[model samples]
Target chain A: MKHFVDTLHISGIREFSEMYINKEDCIFLTIGEPDFNTPTEIKDALKLALDENHTHYPPICGNHELRQRIAKLESMSFFESYTENNVIITNGATEALILAMGVLLGHGDNVMIPTPCFPLYQTQALLTGAEVSNYDTSTHGFQLRYHEFSKHIKENTKVIVLASPNNPTGIVYDEESMITLHRLMEEHPDLYVIIDEVYRSMIYEGEYPSIRDYESTIDRVILVQSFSKTFAMTGWRVGYAVAQESLIKQMNAFHQNLVTGVATFIQEAAITALDVDTQFMLDEYDHRRKYLLKRLALMDVDYIRPEGAFYIFIDIRKYGMDSYTFCKQLADELGVVIIPGIFFGTEGFARISYGANMDSLENGLDRLDQFIREFCL
Target chain B: MKHFVDTLHISGIREFSEMYINKEDCIFLTIGEPDFNTPTEIKDALKLALDENHTHYPPICGNHELRQRIAKLESMSFFESYTENNVIITNGATEALILAMGVLLGHGDNVMIPTPCFPLYQTQALLTGAEVSNYDTSTHGFQLRYHEFSKHIKENTKVIVLASPNNPTGIVYDEESMITLHRLMEEHPDLYVIIDEVYRSMIYEGEYPSIRDYESTIDRVILVQSFSKTFAMTGWRVGYAVAQESLIKQMNAFHQNLVTGVATFIQEAAITALDVDTQFMLDEYDHRRKYLLKRLALMDVDYIRPEGAFYIFIDIRKYGMDSYTFCKQLADELGVVIIPGIFFGTEGFARISYGANMDSLENGLDRLDQFIREFCL
Candidate 1:
């Protein structure tokens, strides 16, 4: 009977999940869950944690051992030198981003989110009573329109949220774009930069350069990374944010009263995920990414080629229908379910995840090609 | 150094952890963490999940098996019938409460809290920009003062927060008190009730009456429970809330954009925990609870005989020092750590957890007696 805040408009990932779960005959590309199993070494670590009685309350920030491991991992991989004080292991990357926005933005303040972005950023901003300003990248090949981004930054903008090897677009921010943004950040020293590097391990273009590489420009940077995508541990829900110790301390205060810590068993598993040699799936995802992009090209769909992560964003404007309607029709008429681009804030486009198995991918694309021929012709 | 919204406060639990963790010589009686290992059956369930590769994103609300188990368990033990649809599994009980407050309370709304309470209620209220009016129970033997509570209710008072078998006081609300509140709630049809039943299984007294026992109250009552205390699965970080389907839906929406869901392996472990018999520890806590109360009665200290949970609240006003300074001095001189009551608001008292091993409890109390006598004299 009581209505929740207006900000929380979407039901959940379940809303999307419900679309395909019961339909055994349907081929779904709508969900974001990875199809890989959790790496065996990580599973072994979890089993060890369970046997060793590491089931009592973990330290609120996290197990110091896990935090220390994460700190080391960040330093070695991203060249981001951070102590344990700078990392707060969270329930997931979603919580890390939500808490980051809660800590950085105040009522009436604003956060800059590039359109066709994960909806969580805008939703969280609204929940905190903060305004959201969008820079549409739909026309710019699904990459940040730097000039528009610069123009949108105002005095009230307190945070900027960016997903690298981005969610729907899969377009990793180029070094030139990051360098320009880093220089601009120098002028707006007051603004906080929240870069979500959850997809860091899945890049196809030989190691994506992190914003952390520009250490001189990182005083206000808060990097959110996760093991969910890389290790296929999304169900384990272990993620951490790397930032200045001061920012982390504030986030820890929130974490302490909010949720004590991520599950201790899961944290052990995450430590295993971080240290293990499990690039088999990362390479597999890259293969799938390239395969899907080539398929899209062959079908003559106008689209942005994803450089990293396993998703392709295609322009479906030629079909003369919005993405939501097109996706529904495709699913009903062709038995292939894809996520509408409008769900990510861009109309006239659709996102197809390449994370599914080879057989499904081929079949889904065949269904899509037939649907396009019938509808567009 | 940007100040946060002022609602987020550093928890006393963190303070206690910091003081006792690396201090090799000190004994701790402060935190609420359990000492037992997670039960083998529960651990195996988690291990099975890891082995079976259930590691990608689970349904945002929860895995169906876990939710169904929780629903069945609640029905069997508490005699409350709930479908899985009525449950929203959360990261922890803390997030269940957080989402409850976020959904039900609007800006400037008020919620009635019983004082000498878990500081979480106050902090959560502050985050939502709602007013928290305490019903001081210190003077009433650590139970809600219905007269004071009813006086505080106004048009803006939207919800009531109560932790049965409470956190600090460990006193369960009497049947008469529940009846009176139930009647009052009938008069205010619009008011929502958020009950934190995290310690439901920790009760050592008469039959614990959940608000669900009252037929008319079913729709408005939201029951928050955890796997932390009963199963010693605190580090597993799993909890759930059962409410009307509508409230669960709203909470799930808040959950999806915030923390998503509990870790999948952790959820599997929690379901096992729910199924296991807790009679052994429940009886153990009961024995310790009675012994601690008897010891407090013989000493020159002041305290209410707790009927449930695992803490004893002692009035330290006799020492003629403030709660914070007194607790710090007690920790230093007595080599025992106790959380200051000021951390839960108000003054001149200390809350000590009796869940420690019996040897530590006995020794800690002896030192506490000597320190109190020396200072008071």
Candidate 2:
């Protein structure tokens, strides 16, 4: 067995979720997916594809039309000209992230990631025998500060991972941070950046800042996005990577053996998905987010006001308990489930997803308030 | 960039297929999937799952019902008791193979593979930083002879990859070879074998011989099966690996980051897929296999008689051209496409798939006959 396999533990998020998954009457705020079902139009498209017998192996990169649509949409969003050649549809953003890491990092290489980051970044970087250097953003309102970020970049650092509308903390990096990142990339010509924008479409306020804004640095940027969050198609396992043709070519070479592309009919559905308006779901999430924030404010519990995605990072350090203990006790005593921040490379904070239904959110928040009052205040 | 990424090339099979895919009037015998659409029952089940909104992340291992059903079916087939704990549903057999390799092989480890084999076995082993040791089965009827296999085993050899009803050759390993494999496992306590039974349900001859027949060796064997060919669901991207609980645990840990799991609704479809009898597709494949064999015999081309799967490895060495040249010329001159065997780690041979519709296969065979006469003869 490989040493890496031994080092690989199930993600703490999953471990905690599974522990309470079967518990009766438990309200789960641990989901990272949209609670909504896939849009009907997308489902109808998939059904049509099945009827048409699109059940053979798809082209390894992806269906060309889906790639073209993705490329066109991304080009418009990023203000860059990207063609079908610049994209490769993947199993999900997870596979896309791993593919990017696999192509760019190897043994003894260093991948600089922001903490509290998605755990997959660390695990995937480690799987490639690359060393992980974490720059903690918890102290700076969950945003990257240039001086602090630069300190973590060693001579061997080959890549930097940034997730806008980040998990655990829903703070999307502002344009200033993106500009600083572009400056850093300019300063370090050898550096590459993997920007995970899986939640790009879920933003509630303002324009999403992308590193692609600086076209000069576009060559080294690997943009990973998914239909999972925006279209509520997580189960469909459709996501894509957009990068320079050279990088896309390398990722495609590796992707050929990684799953031989996503399901063909699903790709067709994804084309329909790109056309479907996600505003309805985003509006619902915004409603829930506002409701939760109001309730939490009334309870006087501190949390980051999430601008995007469906999560709120609640500060539990004041409760004098570690995130794990706080979450475990919350689930056990109140039957409300939330993920520990330790799972996402931070401590003393836990993540509350608002992706659950309003009823669950209202009840879970009430239970959380009760637990906090009884245990802390 | 990782050196391995530099070393990786798109498989020659795909390269050839893509070149001819858009060409007008081309008769392609290059597919490895069943030409039939997925069974109606399975598709309907998927549609129901979608309607019912099973569009969230499934358990990282897989859906419990699907795993339970797979365990039951495999347990009966292998004559060994397997629980859902022993299985991990993957994106496809491609992901399963990579997961197995990622878990078992690391830098400097050796993986012994039989050739001419599926190109993925080698690429995946390389991706793990493991050296691939090929035991060319081409010399001995595409079946591993114990004496020849023994020479490839080194002290650092961690795994042996065997694909029965193999790609290109379409030859199933005999009971004698499996027994010999069991003996080898006994002699080498550290050795593990990965048996790919993706083509198991397509066998035309006697009972599929499995290493699991020797219950004692079951702990050391990892069985990979897929719904792609068997259910004509290649586009669905569903497969599973069955191994001991400990191995499955480690693989699941890796799989969580690989792609989470296959689509939730797709897994539901897979449960229904298991009960849909594949005898109809198998019968069609058998019919095509016999027709192809008879046609090739009439053409006096020396080719292996396929016992399973949908491919026939033809001996084109007599033509005094490399497999690439032979295939390229055949496609160029007659609009018939076949894959070069060198892509599967052997030269001077080409693979002709019978998975094409009868009209295409018949026309392709006619063109093939013309090519042989005009070029080879």
Candidate 3:
């Protein structure tokens, strides 16, 4: 008689955005998917792998060369203490996150997640029967303040889920904030931290900071990242987790029962992805990021400048409308698609992704500006 | 501090089988990996798909055409109640199995698993904190008897996990047994039945019996299958689950959080998989199956004749060794590898796979004969 599904409600992002897929004239800014084509080099490597019959199951952990490639990348990006044992390829960062949940949280355990984070964190925790401890970061520009952890760390809290550059708000944690959080976690050695950095490659300003930079050991930090955002390989669903070897080994156990590993040629393609030039996509995102920032500045609304990722989180509180209603009216009337911030667990704001061409962004933003001109008055 | 990893022990299929990957003289009948080259058509289709850049994140359920193809296959093979809504593509039958567990079993709930069987079923159940009620089918010639279910059913028994053309034992369920199991389920409407049919395509004799033959509705039957064993596409990690619309929807929720569905171009390739001529591989497996059966007939060992899958579960009890010890000693002394039946939860029998070519099978069987002559004496 006990069912977990009733505790879960699918987020509003898809419910509202799916209606616009067939509207050719609609300037959509809804989902986080990028518009860049997968790199020619990566695709070429995949084609070669297909021709060479690399379509067999790689080891459940991953193809050795791919894991090795990820290890080398992790060494430069994360910790030197890590090796191949510390990395395991997953379906994507999505599976990577699920594995983290599997290893860290148990029934009736607590998982602390910042509000307006990816909905999946809460979904997975609930699926595993873990209670989600959501801390609203709306007041702090969506960055976790040290007090946020202090106020919410319960005796049952097992893991802290952090995303940076954060979804919706695109606020990357500063070095000071990262160090302070580490200090708090160091005091509670029992707590685990998983930082999702899918948007690390899309940073428009400053070096992407990682918890690995402040922690002396790889013991507590579990870094989940993907080739989707960086390599325009979202559909490929190739991602990984870098943690202490034991934690990774445990995650691989769950992953082994789940997908075994990502597809063989897909991992092979991802190996070649390491060498592909990602500057074109990053440069384009930067161009669009700046344009959207200027649009935000001129709109006379409260909005945080996106430090990284493609989304701009803007407050719609002045309109006195719920986030879903605001987004619904915006899409239906103005022919623009944007995600309700309530979908990410906050209201009175919505996230607009600028991961599209300049023409669409201009069109969508102009529509937004017109809507604001009429509605704000 | 709490971990599910402790409940999961890696299966010996890998630990012993891996020792031979670099040994040229080694005759391995270990893992169920097929030795046949992947059919050219699936690879060709995949190649074309990659060139066209079919790589993108598929829907959480799957691509429309891929689901349609699977639904069409199910319509003829399963109930007419099946449509795209009844089918959900997974990472493989492995992920499909895991998703079934996620949607069906909750913590402290009971799941019935027949042994010797694939170890992943027990692994996934425990990962979700579900208690596994394993029923040893070794006494029944590795077939699930009506008594097996009657004995194992408990107050919390929520699911009965079945595999047709059983792994390790290779005994397909006869129609009468399938109907009997269905009748038992009909008695307990709350009990779910999941039959893994990954090896359905590899049967050497008799029509593969499905629950669909007796049941007009798909409500209680969840069919998990993969393209790996059948199409010689083990490495692609593509598979599907067919159930009623509601169960598929719940499974899709987990599938969405797990890997967001299989790869895009991979699913596109799968759309072509339905049309790939499968008779070639079927004839090859039949040829190999007859050869192994003949060899088993000449041997002085007790073995269950495999009806479908690539394995022959031979009794090694005469050697007076536990399954793991028997396998280890065989690999060390005879230069052969056979999976320890204990890995599948039954002792005194070892599973030898004929999924390889004629040469490897002959060599491995000869080594086994030599080992038996020396040890059985």
TM-score of each model, paired residue for residue:
0.95, 0.97, 0.96
Instruction: List, residue by residue over B152-247, the lDDT tens digit for candidate 1.
Output: 678777888989988787878877668767876898897888889888778776778666678787688888988888888888788889888877
- Give candidate 1's error at residue A101 in angstroms: 0.5
Who is ahead in lDDT, 2 or 3? 2
What are the DockQ scores of the candidates, in order? 0.58, 0.73, 0.58
Residue B192's C-alpha lDDT in candidate 3? 85
Residue pairs whose backbone atoms clash in candidate 3: A56-B235, A57-B235, A235-B56, A235-B57
CA-only RMSD, every prediction: 2.4, 1.7, 2.0
Model 2 residue pairs with clashes: none
Candidate number achieving the greatest lDDT relative to the actual structure? 2
| Descending-DockQ candidate ranking | 2, 3, 1
Model 3 achieves a DockQ score of 0.58
Residue B114, candidate 3: C-alpha displacement in angstroms:
1.8
Give the runs in model 3 whose Cα sits over 4 Å from its true position: A22-24, A77-79, B1-3, B19-24, B147-149
Write the residue-wise lDDT of candidate 3 on A229-294 in tens digits: 988898898999988888887887777877877888888989999898788788888888888888
What TM-score does candidate 1 reach? 0.95
